[model samples]
Structure formats: structure tokens, C-alpha cells
Target: MKEDLALMERALTELHPGLYRYNTKEEFARKIADFEAKLNEPLREDRFFLLTAQLLSGIKCGHTYLNPYNQKKEIFERLIGRQTYIPFHFRFIDGFFVITENASEFDLPKGSAITSINGRTVDEIVQGLVSVSTADGDGTTLTRLRSVDLSRENGASYAHFDLYFPIFFPLDRPEFEIEAISYRSKEKVRLKVPAMTKQERTAAMEKKYGKTPGYDEGWSFKFLKDGTGYLKIDNFITWKLSIDYKRFLADSFSRLKEAGATDLIIDIRNSDGGDAGVVTELLRYLHKDPFSCETGIRTFIRTAKADPELLKYASVYDQDLKAALLNGVPKDRYKPAKNGLLEFLNGAVACPETEPYADRFDGDVYLLTGPDNASAAFTLAKRVKEASLATLVGRSTGGNLNGFNGGSYLFFNLPNSGFEFDIPVFAYHPADSSQAKDSGIEPDVNAISTASDAGEAFDRTLDKTLRLIKEKQAR
Candidate 1:
């Protein structure tokens, strides 16, 4: 037990002490002590994992996370060992968990405010979830939930929130009651929903969201009836898929340009972010040279010293990365800012030098953003806003523009529990530090989804974006 904790402490000490990266060494010690005390208790593996994950979530670093694909999958599987999941979809709008769709056969209509599940109020569940949730940059649990837009039908936030929901409200029974008020008629409704088997849940999700997720495609560009081109970028990553993101963007702009489309709409809503390569690639077609994605990166420590085990898995290598490992370990709280390396938390070298596209879209660019526009996507929005390349219209971003912490990550396995958590080696603050810390990139024109808007299945943010796009085109 002592050995396991010693390992944890040694690992915890790697985070930047100056930035209070996750928790101070002292605070981390307290949390470790408290968690250690729970080891003696008759805690289940699932519970222990949850406890540790919640502990790590406190750090609020975007890159540092117990990979949900890895740890979160294990937790969800164990939680549903015997019971099935409450097979339905919900969107948290305004303050209520509204029924957007269902995977199983249920009486709940679209837009019904789900007040409770299994006798627990939505507030109580959400309050508990905040601690377990992964939020970005000084965001509270509520802010995290809202930023993710927990109430969406098929979004990145909903996907993550769905994983923890069953665990947070452990349903031992085969069935549970849901209480909700219909948005259409203002009538209250109650139903006993049966749990869904794994296969059943998959089918339902496939139906609720198309088998090919609406936004799953790399990207798409279609000209609106009004001659404005609408390009929806669901995510930035394309390495896993056959799609080439760089080529996709170049072709997209070429087609739009050939069509002589001037005004454009980019819906980054529901985008949880992917490779920053997508951001840089998109920017290449939009901005000129002599610009950088960020001023510099800050790094107090490096992952190699703390969790060297992760070094073997650091497959995303380049000249910059090899140089760092060869240069010897970072001794102090700061490492020399290396462009194209994962050493600096606030990376000095965010974008690789790219000459502007000989012919790029110079017409008005409308970037639709929200709480879900995060990580690299949020960073892209920051660049666009800083460069004055587009008019941002939507809710504030999920996390801040300048004070981002993403770059590289290493997963640290808890010695005692054997469950794992991730820690970002560096914290990246922006070169332009004027933006208020703890706030996401606020929209130049702020708008949120209204109740009436959802009822008609309308996108108020996109509408506002198009209105501005047309308005500018008129000018």
C-alpha cells in the first residue's frame, strides 16, 4: 500500500507546481491520503476507479484525462454487469434534461423535461456528475456540463455524459421511473423504462443518430440556397479514417472558390476537437503568413521523468520530439519552448509554417462556436478571432483560448487500483494573455439555443450566423 501511494505521489509531483496544474503537491497529498484511507473500506473496483477518476477530474486539465475510451469503458462495463442501461436519449436545455430521442420503446416525447430518473432529481445527479466530469480550464461542474451541452441528442458531450450517467445513478433494478414535462403541451408524463441490453442500446443509438453519425464524416461543403457556402466540420481528426483532412479542406475551398462563393458558414458546434493539424490546415486557406497559432508554450516539467512508461507509446514523433528526448530531461519548471514538440504546456510552436493558399477564401467567414468547440477546435477559434478572420457567433467556448493545456499526454496507472489516469506534462497559456482566465472564447455575437428554437428544431446560432453572413454579403 505504501509503495503504491509513493508511486502516485512521485507521479503527481510531475505536474507544474507553479501553475497549480492539477493540485498543489500539498493538496495532492491530502487527496491521496483521503483516497488511501478508502482502500481499507469494502470498496468495489468500479467504485474505486470512479473515486480516482473524480479525484483526477479536479485538476481540470483538458489533455490530462483517464482516457474515456480505455478507463471509462471499463467502468461502464462493470457498472452494467447485471443491469442494462436506461435506453433513451436526452438533451439538457435551459436547466432541464429534455427528451430529445429514445433508443428503446418509451412514451417520452421530444423536448420533455426529464426532472428525475429513478427517483433522483436531475439537479442531484448533475451535481454529483460535475465532480466526475472532465471540464476545461477553470470551468465548474455545471459549466462543464453546459459546455458539453449535456442536453444534445447526438453530440460529443452527450456521448461522454452518457457513459457516466449510469454509474452516477447506479440502478440496481431492471427498471426505473423517469419524470418529465412535455414542452409541446406543458403536460407532465411518467414512464417506467426498462434497461437496454448492449446490443439493444447500439441499435437504438444507430437509429437515433444515423449509423453514420451526421457529423461523423470528415467534413462537407454545400452551397446554401442564398449562394452562401455552408461547411460543417464535425471534427479535425482524420488519421484513423481514410479521409485526408488537409486535402479535404484544400478541395473544399477550391470548389467553393470555383463556384465563386464569397460568404461562408462553418459550424463547429458539436465538435469536441481533434488534431490541431485540421485547425492549421483550415487557417492556411483563410489567413496570410507572418502569423502564429500561439505566442509560446509553458512547461514546468516533462512526462518522461514522471511516467517514463508512457514514453514507449509516444508514437507521434517528429524532429522536434526526438530532439527533446535527446536533449536530456527538463530539469526546472520550464523547458525551452520547442515548436512541434510536446514539451511545452503552452506551446510556442502551435502552427507549422504554411504559406497562404495562392487563392484562398477571403470572403466573410462565419465561425459557429459553442461550449463543445474545444481543444484544437477552440484553439482554432482563438486564432480566427485573434486574426480577425471570421465573426464568431454562438455561446462562449468550452474553455479559454490562450490558457490551453493540451499538447501531449501520458497515462499513469494507479499502482494500488491498477486503474489508470492521465496527466498532461505541460500547461499552455496563450501569447496574448489578455483574455480573462477561466472563460471560454466568447462569441462576437452571443446566442444560445432557446426553448422555442428547439421546439421547431431550429438552430438559432446558425441562423444568426447566416443572417450576419448575408448581411455582410449585402454590404
Candidate 2:
């Protein structure tokens, strides 16, 4: 256990690009010591995993995490495959665990506020979860966004809350003792709900909601009653689907122009980013002038090569890292930077302008953003705000405003525990680094959803944006 912990510490210090970006070396060393002190007694694998997650969360990098998908089958089965999940879907809205969909046999209705779970207050549960939940810098939006299961059909095998809640705060019994305020009656109620496995929860949700659309089918385009063109992009990960995104955007804009639509709303509220190229492609249709996606990209290590000692326990997608001791780093591509870091010469170039499409839409663009707008999606919001290209609506975004660590990663599996965690290698900085390091892109207009909004299936943000457009037209 000690050896594996040492290796983990060494790997982070040597490879993680943003290891010290938000914290000092001494501070990180202290965190490691604190974690080690807890090892005075034996810990179960699940407990150790929780501690490791909390340790990584201190790095403040969104992409850096112990991904459940990458873990071994046995580990996943033992930890998450059990029938330990709460029997409903919910969203944390305005400091309340507002029920969105009830999957259990209970009489609780949508819009009810879950006050407590197994005797733990909602605030206490959230505070404990936030300590372990990973986010970009100090941004709380991503944490709040992830602490829910609003869309079970979005291809995620398990929800964050479902996966971690039971592990963090184990129940004395198999079921959950839940207390909630009734949405319709305005009366406090208590319920004892039986636990469900991941599969069971999916089945219950589908049985109730009739199997809603998945992420692949989530993207859509429609003209509102007021003639505003509404484009809903569920994510930027078009590569996974058969849809030709470039053509899709081109056709959407062409149709809008033909319809003489002077108002367009691009809804990316559910987008947590995917291919950066997709973001750039979308920008071509919206941005009137030439624009670049990033100002610079850098890494801590000069090469993709891994340390010989640690390579055996690490699984890498970067081919250069796979060859480890056999291959050498190409000197021409990487140049030495300050603080013994390596700057990718190819990535350090100034903003390389991309020409706007000839058929770029000239309409007033209203971007509907939310907490899930991180990575490439966050980049889109940042660029649009910088260039005055769109009026952003909804809540603040997820990624850091100054910059974020991504573009590449180093996946490490602790040998003893067989636990896996990833370290983001590249940091992509925006043109403006003057903003707070912990801050996300704030919207031009702030709009939040209420429990009633969820229950009624209403979109407060979109409604507010449409009103603003109508008011502008009135003027």
C-alpha cells in the first residue's frame, strides 16, 4: 500500500501539468502526508478508493479523476454493481434536492424537495460529497450539475450521486429513509424506499418515463412559434455518431437565413464538451470574424514517454508513452519552458485565425449555457463572450475562465489496489488569463430553474431568453 501510494505521488509530481497550478508543492506534500496518516489502520478497498478520490479532488482539475468506466470488472462490480442506489431521479436546484422523476413505487411526486436521506440533511450530504467531487478549480457549478440523475438515457451507466453517495455514507440497512416536502400538498412526508441496483433503476425509470431519448437522439432543431430558430446540441461529441455535424450546422444556418429568422438560440445546456474540432466547426457558423480556439497549449513533461519504473502499472493511449524505455522524445517538437516544463512548439503558436464561413448567420445569437458547459463547450462560451458574438443565458459554466488542464492525459493504475486514476497532461490557456483562476464563464443573464419548473417540464432559461428577444423586437 505504501509503495503504491509513493508511486502515485511520484507520477503526479513528474507528469501532471497542472499539479501545482492551483496549489503549491508544499501544500500538495501536506495533502499526501495527511492521506498517509489515515493509513495507520487497514481500510477496505472501497474506503481507500474514496480517500484517493478526495486526494485527487484537491488538484482542482476536472479531467483528472478515478474514472469508474476504466476500473477492473471486479472492482466495478463489487463497488457499484450492488443494489445500493436511491430509487429516484433528482436535480439539485437552488440549494434543494428537487425531485425530477420518481422511479420508485412511492407516492412522492415530481417537484418534491428531498430534505434528508438516511438521517443526513441535504446540506450535510452535499458538503461531504463536494469535498470529494472533482471540478475545474473552485467552480461549484460542475459539482452541482453532477450531483443529479436528471437524464438516465444519456448513456452514463451510473449517476455520480448514485455511485458515490452509498460509498461515502453507507446506510445501516439496505433501504433509504427519505424525508421530503411534498410538491403539491406542501406537507413534509417521510418514506422508506427499497434500494435498487443500476440496472433496476434504469428499468424503473424507463417503465415510468417510457424510455426517453438518449444522447445520440438528444440533438434537435425546431422553429419556435415566434419564428426563432432553436438549435439544441446535446454535446460536441459528434465523432461518436453518424451525424455530419459540419453539414448539420451549415444546413441549419442556411435554413434560418432563408426563413428570414433574425433570432437564433443555440442550446448547449447539456453539453459537457467532446471534440474541440466540433466546437471550432460550430464557431464558424456563428462567429462573424476570424477566431482561434486557444492562445497556447503546454505540458509538464517534454515527451509522451513514461518512466520505466512506473510504465508497467500504467496504461497509455499515447503511443510514445507506450514505447517507454525503447523510444526517445523528438527534441524538435518540444522546447524547454520555465520551471523545467516542456512547451509543445507546435502548440505554442499565436492564435491561428479560422475564417468565418461564407454563410455565417448574421442573426442575433443567444447561447443557452449551463453548469455542464465545460471543456470545448466552455471554450465556445468564453470565445463568444470575448467577441460579443452572443448573449449568454442560463447559469454560470463549469470550466475555469483563465484556462483548464486537458488535451492529453496519463492513466495510472495502482498495482496493489488495482485502482485507476488519470492525470491531465496538457493545459489549454485562453487569450485572456486575467480572470479568476477558479471562476467559470458567467452568463450575460442569470436564470435558474425551480422545482416547479422541473415538475411542469418547463424551461425558465429559454423562456427568459425568448422574452428578451421579443422585448428587443418591440424596441
lDDT of 1 by residue, 83-168 (tens): 45566666667667766666657656666677888899877877777677666656533347763234323433235555566667
TM-score for predicted model 1 compared with the true structure = 0.85
Writing each residue's lDDT as its tens digit, candidate 2 over 412-475 gives 9998999999977676654344544567889999997787887787899999999999999999
Off by over 4 Å in 2: 139-150, 154-156, 296-305, 321-328, 350-352, 430-437
Instruction: Provide the overall lDDT of each model, using Cα atoms, as 2-decimal numbers.
Output: 0.65, 0.80
Candidate 2 whole-model C-alpha lDDT, 0 to 1: 0.80
Cα lDDT, model 1, residue 96 = 76
- TM-scores, all candidates, are 0.85, 0.94
Clashes (backbone N, CA, C under 3 Å), per candidate, total 15, 0
